[model samples]
Target chain A: MSATQTNDAPPEPGSHRRGLLWDGMLPEALGLCLVAIIFGGLAAGYLVTDYSWKQQSAAAHKAETEAVAQAMATALGCVADADGRSRAGEAPDVAAGPRTGRPSEQVELLMRELGRLPGLRSMHWTREGEAPAEPYREGEAPAEPYWEGEAPAEPRRDCSMVVTVAVRTLGGEPAGELRVERSASADAGYRSLLLWNWGTPTGITLLVFVALYRRLKRHLRPMVAIERNLHSCAQGLEQELQTLTLSDSLGRAAQGWNHLIEQLTQLHQRLQEAQGAEQADVMARFEGAVFRRVVDRLPIGVICVTNSHTISYANASAAALLQRGPDELVGRAVDKAIENPAVMQAVVAAQARSGAGLSVDHTSRDGDQETTLRFRILPVSAQSPSGDALITVEDISQLREGERARDNFLYHVTHELRTPLTNISAYVETLTQPGFDDEQTRKECYNVIVSETKRLSSLIENILTVSQLEVGTARLDVGEVDLTRLVRQMVQDNLAAADEKRIDLTLSLPPKVPKMRGDKQRLCILLNNLIGNAVKYTPAGGQVQVNLEVAENRLVLAVSDTGIGIAAEDQAQVFDKFYRATADAVQAVPGTGLGLALAREVARLHGGEIHLESELGQGSTFTIELPWPTSDQKVTR
Target chain B: MSRILVAEDDPHILRLISMWLKRQGHDVLEARHGLAARDLLQAEPVDVLISDINMPGLDGLELIEAVVPAGLVRRGVVVLTNRWDHGEIRTRLAAWGVHVLPKPFSPSRLSELIESLTSSDVTEPQA
Candidate 1:
């Protein structure tokens, strides 16, 4: 269920997360800077060489134009031409110059004519006649070489070169200086050479950059894939994987990512398990789930109350027994939920005790009735009642009632048994007296002993019957008989007792009362008991009526006695064993209290019921309801 | 002989007790239950009132309660009960100087209880 690994080599996964600068732009920008540094240095050196080449080319162009001027000057002669006199024409310019010598008038025109070169900016000669005369040239050596002419007004912004040459006659004396300015326009040949100087190196550097970029991309591809995969999986933490086969750092990084994800997945699962382990119910982790379930399913009520007097938990059985809902019981104050001071006192006492706990039985009165409860408060923890105390509240009212009943029964039986026994003992003791028994006294004593023994025997028989019926030890002998005939016979058998009391005993039987499927002997006993009780209870001259009727598919054998009747309070208990109606007249009558109880038990065993109606002084009625046998049932006549 | 009042619900037990008390040289008057016993205690001077706890009307405890104020049965009461489980009830009665005789008691035990009651003062009968 667990996997623990130790690898101390790698960085923590979270630490390696790429910052903005490190992810993509840093490597490429650094590469581009390196490329730019090397190439930029080469371009700077090429630029310096091209600047000097332009200077030298412009100088060579100007030198060539100056040489043309020098050749023309050498060809000029300042001597008199042809006539030795100045053949200065009347016009300022001659149309053609003698091929041998140059005239001053034509010199200016010829110099202007030499300005026809294509790159020529200007060709101008400064003559002595155009020079501004100085005021004090007396000590100057003929102002040799005529002060450099005022700087020419060259207006064009192009690479220009200037040359000044002195004009001399054949003897080479200075006549005037011709100034020539030439600009070199970029020609195809020059351009081809310039391109070779700078363009080739730049193109080569671009190729190198392309190769470097490819290498960087190849190296970073896995890392980028890893980052992308990790980010995409960042939400779920366990999803797609970006795998690589390279043994480089990037490949290992991928493996590391997988490992981190695995660790995170395991940790996530642990977190989920922790959440699952949380118990939302009142039963915390102190008890096992199965144990709680079993406790909840118990038939005994259980409540856990905190030291603070709050009902911390109540099981379903507790709720049902308390007649409160489970939710209503928990978190409620103990005084409110239990509401019985006696039970609460016992609970507090138990809480004050330690270890295996304490218990007390209490009877709680709810309105008119009372129920007995046994509260066993147990310790939940070492803290005892400082925490929740486990209380097992068992409603033992029924059990206490049963014990009381048994006690009453035993008491009655002993009283009954003791009476006859006492009589037998007394009479037998008298018989043993020294000659104290006369014949007549002896007969009376003997008769008393016999009757007492008979009483004892009948009491024992009835006690045995009651015991058998109560414990279900005796089974009914089921049979069918004419219920109407049986009822009439029972009444007839009881007529003597009625007559002895001077009670008017009469029978009313439906002509065709339905026969019943039952134990015929028990049915007869049921009827005999009802009628005998009626006759015995009726005063002299009071009417005792026995009516057997069939109604609603039942045989109702009703015996009503017009005598001192049982009180309304004792009616419910008339069928309880060892219970007698405690009125004066009824108490004066001597009869065991087992007849009605036995009769009712027999009736119930035969699927019937006994009902009673009475008033204190008017009369009493007892009815035995037996189910009428249907046509399918076989009736024994 | 000390005139003792015996209150019991069962007739045969009452007769047996009366006979035994007569044999013991005690003048015994009988009542079927607590009501008749209360009447007898009021109408006559008795030494001891022996009674049953459960009866139809005015049971033994009520009889004792009634007679104690009337100063009947000056020698104290002897309570006979068939309820064997009433230890607490017995204790409550014991506070009143009541002696207990459980039902089905032996004649010897009864004799001892009566002897203990009558011998306490060794005084002649007042009535």
Candidate 2:
């Protein structure tokens, strides 16, 4: 069968137009038939009335002529001779007037007898089948002298419009006919009556035509507008489907039609979903189940869009990243499912096989949290029927945050290192210059160079140690470490710095102590950072004390300083890497914020934890608690 | 002698700059940070304003942004920074028409730059 005959085939073109035209023609043809019926009815009524009018008028006309004829015959009888002389052509001896002719005498006699009647034309006498004859007085015999003495000559008259009757002698033998023509006024009356009969029906027909025309226009106008709108949409001239609405003029039909349009819109959406499913089917035919399972299990979001721009496959991660259900993403249009414009643009570009591919970042905020997803479009090269391109989405919020933190760290580290290096470099140059050959200037430059060099070396060491601690790469050099000696040595190391600032540094130890197993170098470094920071930050008269004791089966080593303490808010984050309080006192003291963080890490590595007690602007004490060594490992020295 | 104002947070670098400028026969003013430099500039105009980019209070660019517009520096402003690779800072410094000298620079070279600034006509500051 042809495609047109198939059940799945699309509707034929022009079918809507044909249907609309037919719809329009129904009312038009009906209106035309109505008009014809009214006209036909009026015409038939006019014809019947005219025929009856003509019959009645004919009878009335005949009665009028017969009465005139009878009057004329009576007049003739009055004027006729009793004897045969009057019939034979004898002149009647009537009162003699000025008129002398026989026809004039007859006319005068008839006028005198019958007087003048209304609606009378000329009167004449005629024999059967013969031309109208003259008056009886026109014969040779003279009639009585014309009544009233005078007679006028005969006037012209129509013979066809006349009513006629036979005239007879006193013996009742057939005589010549009498004829009377109707007057113009009498015929005008019949014409006016016929016109009056047709006027009413014509008026009624006109009223009905107007009513029908108005009603049909009201009923069909909305349908026509809807039809036009639909036709424009189907022809791709209009993009908005909601434009297919019927005005309220159609009443319930309008509501029903609008409802139908809504259903059609939903059907269009379903059709798009069906197209996506078909595309998925195509993809399924080309790729195996193993590939599907692998893609579904992938951590990153993977979405495949067919060449037709429908989503053929969307992995679980893709659905989750898009915040949609797994099945909701597949079998949908790429643009509709993916609300990110830049990603959609990249997908379109990839579908055209443009360039290698494009990568776009989509950032979405859900309340307080912001998620950044990177979409990379890769064009399919194998001509697989699955899809035109592949899009991979990776949630890169953490990655980007890490990059930002590293950049910040690098910036601060470089700036910190540059300060001491600049000091060292400038002082060394000053020492070389000739003006700086003096004893005081030379001594000053040497002292600056030595201190700056030491600062630079220590800063570099701190950075390396902290980075290693953070990355879990720092290997511990485990050994037996005497806690009392370690504390004494660390305090001694910071004595010169404390003395320079006039701060008292002291260490106290119990009478007896045991050496614990730990990383000795790391322990020394940790104690040095704490003691050094105490002396550097303390005021000229502030005191720092390092005390070691055994309690609770753990080594309780405390380093307390009467320096600028941490604020309550900053205390929690003071141990975080590269976190520096923005206090003026803290900023004025040149120390890497890595010290406390590194100290904590080193303490944790030896299975110990550091506790802090601080009051802003009063003092701070850092206490370390370490588990005591086991009996076999412990050495009392 | 041309008057020069040097702002640096590092005490040793500040001393070395002061020593070099003094040996060059110029009167030099000193500030420990950008805020002090702003205060000095507001007090008196100078032939040159030399500053370090990183400081505890109000950084070098901010100091220049405050003083240069008020016409405190006579010749031009010069920047000493280690943060030359910082894109936003670099762009801002470029837009200001300030000459940037990275750290670990030679004292003799710095002396020559100071000499040039004192002898040259006033360099207009860019926005």
Top model number, lDDT: 2
Q: Is the docking of candidate 2 incorrect, acceptable, medium or high quality?
A: acceptable
* Local accuracy of candidate 1 as per-residue lDDT tens digits, A1-637: 2333222233345554563325657766877787785678477647754685677677777678778767655434342122123454343222224433434434444544565565765555555356633322334543222222222254222466777767665444565655665665666545665667677766776777778778876656556655444454565664422221223445566566567666766787788787767644334655677788988999998898887778888899889877897799988988888866765765666566545677767676889788887878775576552666778889898899889899888878887787677668767766776543678657867888998997798688779989988887866666557777887788888888788778899999777765556777767667877888888787889999888777887777788989788898988888988888767677766677998998888877776788889898888998877776533233222
Backbone clashes for every candidate come to: 2, 3
Tens-digit lDDT track of model 2 for A493-578: 78898988999898889999988888787888789888888887788999999888888688888889999998999999999878
For model 1, state the Cα shift of residue A108 in Å. Answer: 99
Could you say which candidate leads in TM-score? 2
Docking class of 1: incorrect
- Model 1 misses residue B92 by how many Å? 4.5
- Give TM per candidate: 0.51, 0.59
Task: Residues B1-127, candidate 1: write the lDDT tens digits.
Answer: 7889999887666766776678789999998877888888889869888887776677778888788667787786777776655575567665457777776566556767787788788433221
Which of the numbered candidates is closest to the native, going by highest DockQ?
2
* Weakest lDDT window of 10 consecutive positions for candidate 2 chain A: A1-10
The interface RMSD value for candidate 2 stands at 1.6
For each candidate in turn, give its C-alpha RMSD to the true structure in angstroms.
18.2, 32.1
